[model samples]
Target: MAITQPEEDIEPTGTKTKWQRFKSKYFRMKMLIWWTLLGVALGIILGAALYSVHPSSVVITLIGYPGELLIRALQELVLPLMVFALMSGVFNLRHSGSGTGRIIRWSLLYYLLSMILAVILGIALVFIIRPGRSRPFAANNFANCNSNVTATGATRADKSAVDSLLNIGRDIIPTNIVAAAAAPNFLGVITFAIVFAAGLITFGQRAEPLIQILEMCNEVFMKIIYAVIACTPIGVASLLASTILKSCSIISLLKALALYVATVLGGFLIHSFVLLPLTLIVLSQNNPIKVIRSFLPAIFVGVGTSSSAATMPVTMKCGEDYGCVPSIVRFVVPMGTNVNRDGAALYEAVSVIFIVQAHGLTLSVGNVIVVALTATLAAIGSASIPNSALVSMITVLQALSLQEYIPDVAVLYSVDWLLGMIRTATNIWGDACACVVVDTWARRHAKKNGTLPIKNPEPPAEQEMAMGVDSSKKDEVI
Candidate 1:
């Protein structure tokens, strides 16, 4: 919690002081979440109004630059943010205690399992929805079919999933770290960061300086990102205006977008509500709804901002308040936000399949598997940016030789505002959900195995929260 200074004790600085005080009071997870939603609602209305007016290119350019700038700013931060934050966590391995190892191991195991499952779910949903199919059959959502079924039934093995898998593996652990950095291979970059950070653990306090610097660098990136993100409403309004004018106004585009929008949002709904909550319940044996409600403030912040990195503070804070051990909440949410974007991974997977289907291409088991792998990579590559998944989706499309279909899939951005919010919120929710599950699983095992010292039992959860419980708080059981 932020400390409050007395009104009389503080010196006034005109508009700056009022702004500072306003930020101090309301610039928190709870309030920011509401502000962001307002931005969305207001932007939508403004966008529609502006489009109706047929604004000139000069007007459009001026209005749209803030939104474009926010994205560009985030793009610049993604690489360094991932590198510093993940490396910083790995460097703290030994000092964070024995639990840190399992936290990393099990958290990662769960992250991959959830992501794989999410992608599979997305793939299955896309198969059913067939968003990228020919407009006549797809517009009413398979109500009348067959014209677009030509490319739906066959699976291609020409590219071979095995070869693609091997190629990705080789790229993950590159021969030259510098070369990987220069080329900006996110997988290899993260791999190198993990290796170097682990090596640094051996130096003990000697590594402290570098770790502190990394932490500072991470903070710097965060501040910059958040500052840029505050302009989201302006950007959203401009993008909405442009999108409505260019994309939604076309009848062909509208028909093409119906199923695709439904598919992306449907995938987000299932992943956010069914898949993740169930995983959290099965692993931690906690009430998934209550867990989500406890962190709803933070999740909504992610929804509003559409950036997980920007939602980190709220997530970490909410996780701790929800009874996650402070250490687990602190480390897990930060690192997980950086890497475990389950929703984005699922979106990427669905987008790739959607594009291929739209292009009337033959389907293959190998192609499906390749998409799954590439989607996961893309999720990691563009983890930190909102509405930025398409950038990495291009990478996946190109890998499968589907790059030429990019223009065909451009309709996605028209509805990306809401789609981005839902997906971003889901991504942040998954991190907090994983934190609770991991904390529960780790502490339960630690207690049984004598690694964790036993303490007083926690009060009833409702009673504790009602009483503002602090002293008797303990990690929940699985």
Candidate 2:
């Protein structure tokens, strides 16, 4: 009776313990969210107040130092995180052959469709809203801008969309893997990880030790990520305060570019809020608003860092809460970080047209087509780093042979910092949605094709035994 009594008592105790843990975790997440929002609010207020005092550049740098450290910490982890996550995720796959291909096809399809919609929407909005029509270009408009900003026109004016595409292909098959990693070429690193994992899988049991090691490494990195995530509120506050301090003179620039800013913000709002959620609803029939709410932490991180790659860790951390399997989140979100740049596409397209309109010039129908297509391609080729789209925009300009107005691109730089954050938030949001959508689609497709295995297929007895429950007491535990 004593033995049976203890066994019987185990179930409720375990259940209660798990419930307590759940509540604790849920409360922690809520607190993190509230604290992060508070940081943003405080940072903005601090920046605004300091701006009136005309703080020195040295003070601004000091204020932003904490945020800079956070960025470096995240950046240092990105390569290892991508490599281990990809390998470990592939190892978890039941059938990498068909399963991997299906996931890739769906990911690409989602990226392509989303980028096109965003680009088309931006182009339509720019033409309809005509933000640039009121702000005709004048030489003095950019006179206050730094020479470096104006000189960006000549920086990458030589690289067209074709060159960018070729570079991407070359990056995928890097000759020196070390050089690629050193260059932090994400595409190359991803290719190497995938191939290495495939080799391990091909060896079957022979590679089990190495695969297990990779899995352990992945878990260790995730633990480290959790630690980093806990410091996000502090980092976000410092980042925002520094950004505002740096752009203290933004009020005049904001007034100058208010219409243009409104147009871009309007496009981002429509795509992220209306179009993306609607797509999630129609495709998966899931409550996307809830998903978006779950992803707020990642979105806020993106805003602070202004880099999708930097925000990738946080995005994946939120994936479980977003109801996506780790495998889908690992594979889809990383790839989306590189290729699925709806926000960049939208921003580039609108910027190109807005620049043209601000100059009191109109593109030919052919040139407009080229701008839209190049913007889409350029965005895909863009690095998932801060202000990379600004560099990639050079390709769109060169494609349409609009090099003369390249210097005019600098005029937009005054506001690029603010716009960069907005676009990055949109990009992170798209990546999160891609994970959910791809996971749902892949499951449905696999089931329809009769390839889906029953989830948690093992019997309760075995599962409990593996979990350290006494086999004789498994029935009672169940």
After superposition on all C-alphas, the RMSD of every candidate to the true structure, in Å, is: 8.9, 10.0
Instruction: Give each model's whole-structure lDDT.
Output: 0.65, 0.68
Tell me the number of clashing residue pairs for each predicted model: 5, 0
Residue-wise C-alpha lDDT for candidate 1, range 279-370, written one tens digit per residue: 98788898998898999998877776677776676787798788877656655676687678888899888877876665455456656776
- What is the clash tally of candidate 1? 5
Model 2, 1-478: lDDT tens digits are 3445554335433343333443444455445445556666666677778877767767877877776676556556645765676675456542333425667677778888888999999999999988766434422222333322233334344345566556656766899999877765556766788789877888877887888899789768756755765665576677667655554254543454788888899999999998889879987888987898899998997887777766666787788676676556655776787678889999999998887765446655545666777688668655565545755675566555465555445446446667888999999999988888888887787689787522211123422222222234222210
Stretches of model 1 off by over 4 angstroms after superposition: 1-95, 135-158, 173-193, 200-249, 309-313, 316-321, 362-364, 381-385, 388-411, 450-478
Model 1 has an lDDT value of 0.65
Best by lDDT: 2
Q: Which one wins on TM-score?
A: 1
Task: Provide the lowest-lDDT 10-residue window in model 1.
Answer: 136-145
